[model samples]
Target: MADNLPPPSPSTSTHHDSTTKVTDMDIDSLVHCASYLTLHDISNMVLSCKFLNRVVYSDTIWRRLYREQWPEQEPYIISQTSCASAREAYLGRYTDLQRFKFVDPLVYDVHMGIGAKCSDLMFSNNSILFSQGPVIKILSIDKLLEGKTSIVSLNDHRARITCMRLFPLKETSLFRNKAQRNESVLVTSSSDHSIRLWWKGSCQRCFRGHNGPVTILSDKLLGDGTGKVFASGGEDSTVRLWSMSSGGKRGGQHALKATLYGHEKPLVLMSVVKHKASLLASVSKDSKVRVWDTTISSDRSSCCVGMTCVPGVPVGIKCHDSLLYIAAGSSFVAVDLRTMKTAFKTSTRNQPKLFSFDILPSKFLACTGGVGRAMLWDIRRSTGTGDADPMAELDGHVGPVTHLHMDSYKVVSGGREDPYVSIWDADTGNQTNILRSSSNLNLDGGGCGCCGMAADGFRIVTAAYNGEECVVNFRDFNNAVFYGAFSDNVTGSKFWCPSTSGHDHAGDESDV
Candidate 1:
């Protein structure tokens, strides 16, 4: 009876307050539970106590949130945020990214020095590779930042490099633990009718089979970012298979494994797939296509499994899934290999000739060729209906658009007659900056007729002409901490590298 009457006496009888204080929980428990709070809830929670403030504002909270949102950027961005608080890192990374358009990039010019004409610009890790005629040149990001033009040149190709591709080292982590961290490999095809393999600044193997100048090469990477075999097409109207793997030798042939014949005209472009049945697709100048299966092998030249004709001259060929997507002049076609029938075909009806095709931003197909602008198309549409109107158009080029490239952030397009490359917001079609060559940085800006372009979030690589000769320009951005280190020593520019203080720079005259 006494225990029954004493139940209410804990609050009244004990010398303690009857309040629910957040201090009742330990800091570890509070911090752990902070993950469940919305950012707004956390903000309110911090107002209650200094202890709550520290818990909610923990670095782990911001870092986890950042990683959850932008997992793809972790590898490229982790180094920059190491010392900063996760809150500062998140703010800097996010705010700096949002202001990329407002800021200009520091342009570092590199004259290939071998010749004035170069093409097939590619990026592997932090290095840029391009072909100046037959000379393969590579420049690294670290050296470029030092205002140096250090280049590693390989002159093994006897003639001009017609086409090239890069297989970069595999990015591995807990996410992709099974990936191979193979050394970067460069494959280049030349007018000498040979395809050569380059590894570690030297030519490893020279594959000879094409009868005429090799026009195109497709070396699509597999899961490990390493493909032992590759495909090359040439003026000889044949597609040949070459391998750099150890057991490629047969009858004293080091790399040449098989040859395929199906096109009536010279092969203009080739696209590869890892699909079991349809391994490759090649397009010819005469609007014909030849597809080969995984089992396609021959002592001499093998017969293709099928051939299809695409409308107009083929300008681009890219493979996705089991379908071969070919972009010809004023038309786009996708062939379903399993059914061997046209899946989806779109004709612009001579609108402006689609010149290039690429997969960008959630696998959208973008083309640049019609009317000095880049057009984004919906590649998933399977009807025979023609998409006369592109989803969006990026304009401002004065001449016919010739070169195009993009990454997660921007779409860079150049024209045949325009010296400047227009940088556009990928999500919105707004033109952000018109980047020019720093060749005449002190006086007048020079021409940069972009031949090939590549970009990551931090840098832009262009195989372009600097009015005098072909130069590969490296444009650096997002170095917020390093912006204060401005110097007159070659790589310095106040115009390009703006302050990261979140000020309005929309009206700044970057031309100076």
Candidate 2:
């Protein structure tokens, strides 16, 4: 009792002094607490007092922030360190991403007004080439930056443009001189029963074999972007393979390599898959699906390898690892390539009328159904099951969702009646963003002519009705980082390279 009473009285002066000296706390203690603060809070703290400046600039704090911002890139980002190199690395990465500013809506908007509606679009070498009626318009990305609507118009097709593809040049030609072999070459199909090859905005050759209007065109179908060999399907009930040997030096024109004839009705081209044997898959209005072998030798004519006759029109087709996934009527059927037999079928009784389908890298199928509904089916979980409920159903558009474009993180869908583009989280099926134009559109289906969008991890390009096109910036969408360099190898994007960086220094854009 005596020791306890004496202990407090002896240190009374020291304890009182310590309590009064709170304002003079050491820098380490304050900085460790600041570590829990956000970057903006720390930034304010730096300006609050000279003593806190050092604390805010600590390498440890910045390293934590960097890791928090780009967790997937930690293995590559946090490996290198510096005695005084925290903010420099982070700032460098930030500035390096300035070129990839498409995800930022505040940056800029490109508005172009043409007389006709845009049907399809493709990007190449910072230039946009799209179809409108019987014409194709070419606009440079630089021109868009300057708010210019002046475009190089290519008018040749006699009727409406059906589809177009900008295929890349051969590897040898591309590596030799990319500027010369730029995506200036285009293949277009039209309702005029002609497939024309264009070079530098001029028709180089005309393929005039299809008896009926050519509706679809495919490039790089054989897993090579050479733009040398391509296939076209038309209302003539046939599929034709066309090839331009390297530079087409033989006749300086495309040659008809093979013509596949099997489908009982007019062909509706879906997709081409190259496996042990190259296949050209197309569906018809009569619900007949045909897969033609394009890998036959020159001496042997190409023939139909497999066929599937359904009751309703097949909407779409996708191939992964030799397995064919078809969305027809109210079910998605998986066909084995080896046996050409039905491997499994999953029905969507609750959500019928499957129009278009896309298979995610994770084997999840995202299909657009009746009335602007996009449903996701986990094939691994739903395979061989009958009428399994979808994993998630996303509804946003006011009208029928006609087209869907998806990456690992997001899904961008457009509808027949809605003028807006809805972006959704692919995993959670939650609507993340809705982008619309300022112009008022009055029609049954505005921006419904084309619903698909193209993304380069930064910007999304989409075509709409009334001759309108929207380029949405997706830069900071959900704090997306340039993780394409560090994504998992199983996602089929292991070799994806960032195309929007402005600076590069030994692969580290940061000066530090």
Candidate 3:
């Protein structure tokens, strides 16, 4: 009996031992397995073999995974109608999030622990400029990426640095003396009531006239091909235009070209619109938006071309076509530059204090503020009665959203609490990745001061109120290094690249 039980047919044993190989699995089985893997893992699988790549990289699978990761975007992704369109949208969003399994440690940071509050920051010519107290610290972006300290600290102001604008001049026979053909000019304003001009890091000229802190800087090119000039608005309730004068036929320093006074309160923001001619738009603490003609830059030479009162103090203003998009308090107001009237006004949920709002090319406005969320509204679909709801909401930050920056593909936001710079897909409003800080740390009594897009298009540089500097590379979105103590407290910052061609202020006509 034992022998009979032990004896089994060779055919039966062979059949029982048969197993299905992985390569033999159907597309459904492969996709099911791929679903459990992270995007990076799936990418690795695709790269492992040609057949796997063809099988694993299907748009259907990607669409399913994208929807799973960002369900709120399902409506938009599904509305593409055509499979090709949906796939293209998915790839666009996916490529912006680029799959990465690991990230290198924070690449670079310099500790400029000068404990002054940083008011603003900017990036240009492979360098980053940030204002701390009355001094501006410049760090080379390329040097920072290599973990080296290449800084040029300029202490030209007596008080705090409030605003800065960089203008690229066209070097021709007429304006050859203004600057080197390749070099751009830097204009900075300070609480010291002075605006200084810098060419190649040296303070070339200083214009002192404002009785209070200068908070705004805007520049426009002269139509006569002479040179470009800039405008500044300050706490003294005046807008002053300055240009490199050709005094006595000799190249002169920056001189006061025009002074227009209209705002009853300190101006918070200003923009020079190139529409029809150079038109200047300024917002003051008095809740009034004033437009001026830059051509007639003297007192009484210009009347407010388009003026409107909003429900809250205007903090930010952007112009596109004939519309002026304004951010005031927690409400967003749209003004028709032609009619000089408020076309639409709407408040974010809970009336969160809106810090900054940018108008995107898609006719959508992206705004962030005291809330832990970023709000988006379609201006074309609004009801124009201060009752429009957000078309989509991006929620991730644990702290009040401080600043936002948007480009062709993504929207990046930073807050005071979260150690991550949240990045969202511009089209779908889906959070694709979080640029995590190396240290799980929060700023004490400080938050993100500002954020700006780099010339590389794939990088975003941000400054924190506690003097922290951050750089996020979209190609590797998961990791970022926080260079804390770069300055005491950064109030404002900008990113400028030498490789940046054309005038920096030219397309700024549409910047938010």
Candidate 4:
């Protein structure tokens, strides 16, 4: 009976459970397992066997890795090569980021065709709207790629172009429901004492009444999201209301809706809230600030509900919930709009004194003074320690830091003290590269300082001197996509829509 229990086995007598081959698993299961491995680990895994090679390259595995590595890139990563797979997209950015260690090799180009020093610059779609003296040059990215070098010029302003801003255009398109983002109208102020509205690169209307140069343009639109109305201020010491629609207008006074007269000194900076019945704050050269109820700016008049004065002339003013943050010489102070009193003042411990300050998307404070270094402070941490360690110190400028722009990917600082634009990784707070002009005068020579700088994820636009010519240098990082000739996505992007969703998308903005 015992002999009938299967014939004698020729194999080894001791046998355990049969080993399960990884290749035997389903494709999905294999792909998921490989995802846990690092990119380098998967690279080696694929070479070990043909089956793993296929699994490592699967969309499921690569997509997860791509986003994890560069969450700021699209959820579906778009490869810089245009034809590569998700794996290629991940590899490209990974390699590009590695260039931070050796900055001299970072590839870039300078386009002197953008004209002399850009006093004001901005990106509209793909084309850049930059001011060179009084002329506005619109240059396309494709032209630069093809080496055309030619640009469209708009010389409507008689005097120098002082400031420029973009506000969301009211959606009137038949396919409005399908649009992912709102179209915008360009609102530019000039020393010519005029405020012009432009759409699709064409000037639609002009409103003129300022007695002196139009020195101030509200950074945000007034009212809700209509985009038809805006406000302007000038050295004449008056805040004038302007609208796109003929909202119950009388004769030819539609564009010049109303005038708000309260300030005594010349206008320095102004800010407007976008919410309904939103409040507008205007800062004058005399350091006095006036808060007006913009929603009440109807019936031919708007009332100044609150007023306050700062230590010295302010460089910037921004409106938040019930408060106005002013950047002055000694300190960055937040003044309560309701009570007209100083609510809180940022620490003045750092030397050189606070020349100006900005509120980052993180709600942390970034300040710049006469010194070369830009400091980041976490005001929240100060609650427990009375004084918190500086969150990050960006110190790479050759001299005094002039301007800086920060997004999720990196922090860019530049100034008149030096010619180079220092790019630092925001996450690591490490210097990545130094961007300069291709010209010998800009590269080896002195006097070429960055007067102004604007950056997106893929490119950096700088206002520098190429010898004696003030040139707007377009330094492209060779991104696979560009929206227009000077289209700037992300970086200094303004989110018009107010939200309290509480979802964190920190580096989620790829800004193509």
- Tell me, by TM-score, which candidate is best: 1
- lDDT score for candidate 3 against the true structure: 0.60
- Runs in model 2 deviating more than 4 A are 1-115, 171-184, 223-228, 246-254, 297-302, 362-365, 437-452, 466-512
* Candidate 1 local lDDT, 272-307, one digit each (tens): 764642367778899888777635445334546667
Off by over 4 Å in 3: 1-106, 117-119, 171-182, 219-224, 245-254, 297-301, 437-456, 465-512
lDDT of 4 by residue, 99-196 (tens): 22222122324455444577566666677677777777787867776766667877778988878888766521211343636677677889988877
Q: Which of 1 and 2 is ahead in lDDT?
A: 1
Model 4, residue 316: distance off in Å is 2.2
Shift in Å, residue 511, candidate 2: 40
The deviation in Å at residue 66 for candidate 3 is: 25
Any runs in candidate 4 off by more than 4 Å, and if so which? 1-116, 171-181, 225-227, 246-253, 274-277, 297-302, 350-356, 361-363, 382-389, 437-439, 443-447, 478-512
The 10 consecutive residues of candidate 4 with the worst lDDT sum are 490-499
Q: Where does candidate 1 stray beyond 4 Å?
A: 1-100, 168-180, 221-227, 247-252, 274-278, 298-303, 380-382, 437-448, 466-468, 480-509
lDDT per model vs. reference? 0.64, 0.61, 0.60, 0.63
**Which of the two candidates, 2 or 4, achieves a greater TM-score against the reference?**
4
User: How close to the true structure is residue 380 of candidate 3, measured as C-alpha lDDT?
Assistant: 70
- TM per candidate: 0.72, 0.67, 0.67, 0.69
lDDT of 2 by residue, 1-512 (tens): 77666454655646454343423778778768877998789878878867778777777787788779756546555444642376776654543332221222322333445456564766676676777679987767666656554478889899999988876543222234646654446778999998877775677677878899997886444434444467888898788877655343233233677778777677765566645426766777787877777766553334777887654557777776777777777787887867878878888766657766677745465555556677776777766836777777877666666667766766667665566666666666665555552223333444443343455444556654543443322112223333222122111111222233423211121121
